[model samples]
Target: MRFQLGWSLVWATLILAGCASSRPAATTSGRSAVDYNSYNEDLSSTRPVYNAPLTNVTPVTRSAAPSATAPAPTATRKNEIRKPNPPIEALHVNRELDLILDTIAIKNRTVRYAPGFRIQVYVGNQRQDADAVKLLIYQNFPELSPYLSYNQPTYRLKVGDFMRRIDAERYYASIRRLISSAQLQADKVDIRRSLLIK
Candidate 1:
């Protein structure tokens, strides 16, 4: 019974110590007890006061009257053109960007092919039939230029280089009226030729 009582007291003391604040005990002089507000005031008073450093520059004392030798300040008119402080040539940067732009411009000037739509007017083994359809396309729509390709037994007759399906469809609708077998086929088209027709 004595051993159990001693262990219980030790556990209670350990719990009380753990629950106590970690702050140093406040010094009290000529006072019975310190209030919470007064303890906070005392802590604030112990802190160092903050003071910002001043600039070391001295003030320039200019005379009220202008000197006779000093040049008069010139004011620009509203319409007058002023020379740039730093010229436009100085602002140029990114040498790699210039090279990339030059390469793009060169590529643009040359013929470039893109995946686009075309109207297929005829596909047959006979060359004469393809020629007849090509003539008929020219007679009906003078703006469209037909392309005739022959591969062994098959000959494909396609017309108009279109970048969009909608653009091809517009001509397809008109061509289908004349040729019942006309279709919109996806093909690699010349960007320059398509843009010219557009």
Candidate 2:
């Protein structure tokens, strides 16, 4: 009975000591609690309010100290306007290249039209319907010149002269809003007319 009693007392003492050590210590300062509260209130009053307008805030200016390695700023020229260099009067060109370029230019002028791709806007038996679609395209998209042609029973309305299928497809996408039936097709595209339009 004595041994059990002694063990219980020792356990109780140890638990009490641990709880007392864990608790924060209160230190007595020279200033009273009332003085500390008044100091905090003064600080809060003096501090600037966050709701002030952004325009009222002054921007911080930075001063750049020049270093020994830094290059000095060049003085601005009195005449700000720049004059272009004189154009060269004479250009040296190989005789063979000049002849080839001249031949190509001559060939281009002679060839009025060539086999390429064109966007067919509409194809129907009624000529009036074809004319209506052509007029609509011209009114909205003046860049793409619509052409109407009669082939026996049907009247076809074609727009844009594209040398490549990719170019024709791009044009077809734009005109598809006006005429849903428009599609890219291989036809004799007017080379000279297309160049002039571009």
Local accuracy of candidate 2 as per-residue lDDT tens digits, 110-129:
88888888888899999888
lDDT of 1 by residue, 1-198 (tens): 999999999999999999997865656665435466655334786799976432332333344775798643322334332222333454465566798899999987885888998899999999999999999999988877788888999999998889988989899999999999999899988777788665
For model 2, the superposed segments whose C-alpha errors exceed 4 Å read 1-93, 196-198
Q: Which ten residues in a row have the lowest lDDT in candidate 1?
A: 52-61
| Model 1, CA-based lDDT | 0.79
The 10-residue segment of model 2 with minimum total lDDT is 74-83
What TM-score, over all chains together, does every model reach? 0.53, 0.48
Give candidate 2's error at residue 55 in angstroms: 77
The collision pairs in model 2 are none
